[model samples]
Target chain A: MGTEIRVQQDDFSVADEYQQLAQESSCGAVVTFAGLVRELAEGQLDAMTLEHYPGMTEQVLADLVAQARGRWQLGQVTLIHRVGRLALNDQIVFVGVAAPHRKAAFEAAMFIMDFLKTQAPFWKQEHTTDGSYWVAAKDTDQAAATAWQDD
Target chain B: MVKVKFFAALRERLQCAELDIDSQPSDSVAEIRHRLLQQHPSWRRELLDNDVLCAKNFTFVDLQAAVNPGDELAFFPPVTGG
Candidate 1:
C-alpha cells in the first residue's frame, strides 16, 4: 500500500507530488486530480467560505486515503485540502494515487472525492452579491457513498 | 441521546450549535426535525426553502432514514461544495 498525508493552507503542486508518489519502478501509472474554486457554485456565488471541523476533518480525510490504499496497490496516495477564508482562483483540494496500472490510479482518485464530498464534515459558505449561503451536504452525495459499500 | 450540529445559514437561523435530542423509540430524521421546530421557531424557517439539505452521521440523508440513540444528525442548506 502507498499513501502520503498533509494539511496545508497553501496550495500543493500535483505534478511535484505525483513525481514522488510514482517514483518506484514497479508503479506504472499515477493519477492526480485538483479541485479549484469556481466563480459560480450551484448557480450562485459572489463569495464562498469553506468550513471544516478542526480535528475531525483531518481524521476523515486521512481515513479516506487509507481506504483507497486498501483497494489498490502500487506506490502512494496524497490528499491535500485547504481550510480558512479562500477566494476565487484558489486551489481547494488535491488527490493523487499511484498504482501498478492506470485504471486503479484513475478510479481511486475519483472515488475518494465523491466520498469526501458527503462524508467529510467540511461545509461551504457562499456570499453572493445579494446574499451569502452555506453549502450543506446533499442526498446525492450520500447515495454516492453508499455505492462504495459494495466495492 | 445524540448531539446534532448546525452550520452556515441553518446555524444562523437556529442561532446555536450542538442540539441535544433525547432518544425516542421512533425518532427519525424527519421526526426529529419536526420536534426540533417545536423547540425553536426558527428551525422551521429553512424548510420553507425548496432545497434545504440534511445529513445523518455527517453524510447526506434522505427521507427513508431514521435517527436512533447516539446517531449524529445534521441539517443545513443545499450544498454548494465543489
Candidate 2:
C-alpha cells in the first residue's frame, strides 16, 4: 500500500525491511536486493565516498519507483540507499518489492535496480592510499538499463 | 534566470554546486553551456565531455532542450548509482 524510500548515511537492517514488507497481507512474494561496497581493484581501495544531488535524489527515486509500480501489480517497494563514506563490504543499497505473484515481484525489483543504476543522481568516489577518484559509469550498466526500454 | 547545477566529479572539477545563469525560456540548454564555457574556459572540456548528461527541471534532457525562467538545469557525469 505504501512505498518507502530513504536516502541516508546510516546503515539499514535488511531483516527489519523484509519483516515490514512481509506483513503486508495479500502479498505472496517479496524480492529484495542488497548492494555492497566491494574492492575496486583487488584491495586497492580503502573506502568509497558517495555524493548525491540532495534535492533531486529523492525526486528521481520516487519517479523510478512509480514507473515500476505502473508496470506491475506491486504491493510495496522499499528502497534505501546510503551516502557518505562506506567501508569495504558495507551495504550500499537495498531494493525490496512485494507482489501477489513471484514473477511480478522479481521483475519489478530488477527493473527498479536497473533504472536506479543509470537514472539515480548519486555518485561514488573510490578512496585509496594514493588518493581518491570518482567512479565512472560503466558501459555494462548502460547496456543493462537500455535493455529495459523494450517490452 | 535559470538555476544551473553540477554534480559528482564534474562538480569537484568545477568547484561549484549551483549557479544562476541569466537566460530566457527560449534559451536552449546548449546555449547555456556555451555561455558557461565562455565565462569559465577551464570547464570547457569537462562540461563538453562525451559522458556528461543534462537534466532540465528534474528530468533528463538533451543539450538542445529549451529552458524557461526558474527552471532547474543540472549537468553531471553519467550516473553510477545503484
Candidate 3:
C-alpha cells in the first residue's frame, strides 16, 4: 500500500527519496543504505562492468523485497540498482525501507540487501591490476542466503 | 525471434556464447538447455550446477516454460553484481 518496492537503473536522489518515504503518518523511522562501487575487490578492482539477465534482475529484486515484506511489517520499500560500466566510487545500489519503527526498517533493509548480494541475477567483471576476472560468488554471500531459508 | 547470447564467465569456458536456436513449435527452456548440452557438454558443468543462470531472449527463465522456435536461448553463470 506504500510507494515502495521499486527497482530501476536510472539515477535516483536519496535525499528526495528519504523525504518522500518519511512523509507518511504511519511511519516512525526510515532506514536506507547507499552502496558505492569500490575501486578494489580482493585488491584488484580498477573498474568494473556489470551485466545482468535483464528480465530476471528486477524480478529477483522484487522477490527479495517481497520476502522482506513478509518477514517484517514494513510500510514501503525502495530498491534501486544501477547497471552498465561504473567508475570507482560510483553509486551502485540503494536499499531503503520504512516501517512504524526503526528496528523493522533497519532489519528489513539489511535483510533485503543481504539477499540481493547473493540471490539477484546481476554479475560483474572486475577490472584489475593483474588481469580482469569475473567476480565469483563468495562464501559469505552463500551463507547469507541461508537467512531466508523457510525450511 | 530474438537472438540469444551469453557473456563473461559463461563465454570464457564455452568459447562461444551464442547460437541460432531454430525454435521448435513447442520448445521450452528445458529443451533448449538439453540441446545445448548435447552440442557442448562442457556447458553441463555450468548449467546444472545450481549456480548458473538461463535467459530466453535476454530474460531469465524457468526451464519448464515454453519458448519460441525462432527465439534464442542463452545459458550463463549466476550473476555477481554489487
DockQ of 2: 0.83
- Residues A61-101 of candidate 2 have per-residue lDDT tens digits of 99999999899999989999999999999999999999999
Q: How well is each residue in A57-147 modelled by candidate 1, as lDDT tens digits?
A: 6677777877777786646788888776687778888888878899988888888888778666667876778787666566888788788
After superposition, the stretches of candidate 3 with alpha carbons farther than 4 Å from their true spots are: A3-11, A41-44, B1-4, B12-20, B23-31, B37-50, B55-73
TM match of model 1 to true structure? 0.70
Model 1 root-mean-square deviation? 4.5
Candidate 2 residue-wise lDDT, B1-82, digit = tens: 9899999888889999999989966899999999899889999889999889898888889988988889999999988877
Error of 3 at B33 (Å): 2.7
- Sorting all predicted structures by TM-score, with the top scorer first, yields 2, 3, 1
What is the alpha-carbon lDDT of model 1 when measured against the actual structure?
0.73
> Scoring only chain A, what TM-score does candidate 3 earn?
0.88
Measured against the true structure, the TM-scores of the candidates, in listed sequence, are: 0.70, 0.96, 0.79
lDDT winner between candidates 1 and 3:
3
Ranking by lDDT: 2, 3, 1
Interface RMSD of each: 3.5, 0.9, 2.6
Error of 2 at A12 (Å): 0.5
Evaluated on chain A only, model 1 obtains a TM-score of: 0.87
Report, in order, each candidate's fnat. Answer: 0.29, 0.84, 0.57
Query: For each candidate, what is the lDDT?
Result: 0.73, 0.91, 0.75
